[model samples]
Target: MARKTKEEAQLTRQQIIDAARAVFHESGVSRSSLDAVARVAGVTRGAVYWHFKDKTELFHAVREEVSSPLLARSHAILDSGDYADPLDAVEAAIVDFFRILEDCPTLRQVLEILILRCEYVDDFVDVKAEVMQPAFEFNERVAAAYRRAAALGTLRPGLEPESAARDTLAFTTGLLHLLLGTRDANGIREQVPAMVSAHLALRRR
Candidate 1:
């Protein structure tokens, strides 16, 4: 009986999260309200309070839906010393980010919400700040990888590691911007691997 009740509680929590994403995505977080999320979830306003403290917290929870898995992979690659080829690990990680979009519809919706729907301002400032930490971590990780690659003679001679890291991140971000802004998934997937390959080709001897 207790187990069943716990499962129901978890189910309700997820329902609230999903509803929050849709509401914030459609209405934009600045304009959205917890009452709207509760209505969308078909739950009492108290249920939302039961699951989340407020709208900002709900927004973070929604962002974590995608960011958490990516963060874990980034941390693992950054922390692990066993990789025989750091370049391949980084390339695979980038490819996986694109590949998941094609395969996961819910993730695609959540990403669309993040990249297209929400604007960062006012109450969203703290949420934006939380996201910056991961970006800094990723910058350090990629910079370290480029430095190691340069040391091993894998990167083109005389290339600056920090510049290369920043450029790579910029290029990746641009690709994501184009993909999301245009909503061009069909040709995008076919070109993604080639794009990554060409980017790496320029760096290698």
Candidate 2:
């Protein structure tokens, strides 16, 4: 009975999180309320409060549901040191990120919420750092990879690893803005690989 209760509780928690994502995506964070989330989840308002203390906590949970997987995959790729060429690892990580974003509607919605919907003010003021932490970690990992590639004499002679890393990040940020703003998954998948390849090619020896 205890095990069944725990499983059911977990399900309810996930349902609340899913509903929060939908509500936050559609209504934006500040405008959304716990009552709305409960309605969407088909649960009592107390159920949401039982799982999350407040709207900010629930928002954090929603963000983590999507960011955690992407962060884990990136850490696995960039931290493993298993690739023959670190730049190959970098390229693979970038491509895999795009692939996941393209395949997962939940990820897309959460990303849209983070990027376009929510404002970093009032209760959300501290949330900006948490939201951006993944990007910061990603930049550090990619910079490390570029540094390793440069040591291997894989990068162009004059190219600086940190500079290359920054440039690559800029390109990626621009591409993400375009993809999210336009909701152009098909166009992104069709063109992004070649675009990423060309960007990496410029850094290669």
Indicate which candidate wins on lDDT: 2
**Model 2 residue 69 CA deviation in Å:** 1.4
Per-residue lDDT tens digits for candidate 1, residues 46-132, read 999988998878888888888888778766765567766567666766777778777877777777777778778777766766766
Model 2 regions lying over 4 Å from their true place: 183-185
Candidate 1, overall lDDT?
A: 0.80
TM-score of each: 0.89, 0.95
How many backbone overlaps does candidate 1 show?
Answer: 0
**Per-residue lDDT of candidate 2, residues 119-162 (tens digit):** 99987898899899998888888899989998999978988888
CA-lDDT, candidates in order: 0.80, 0.90
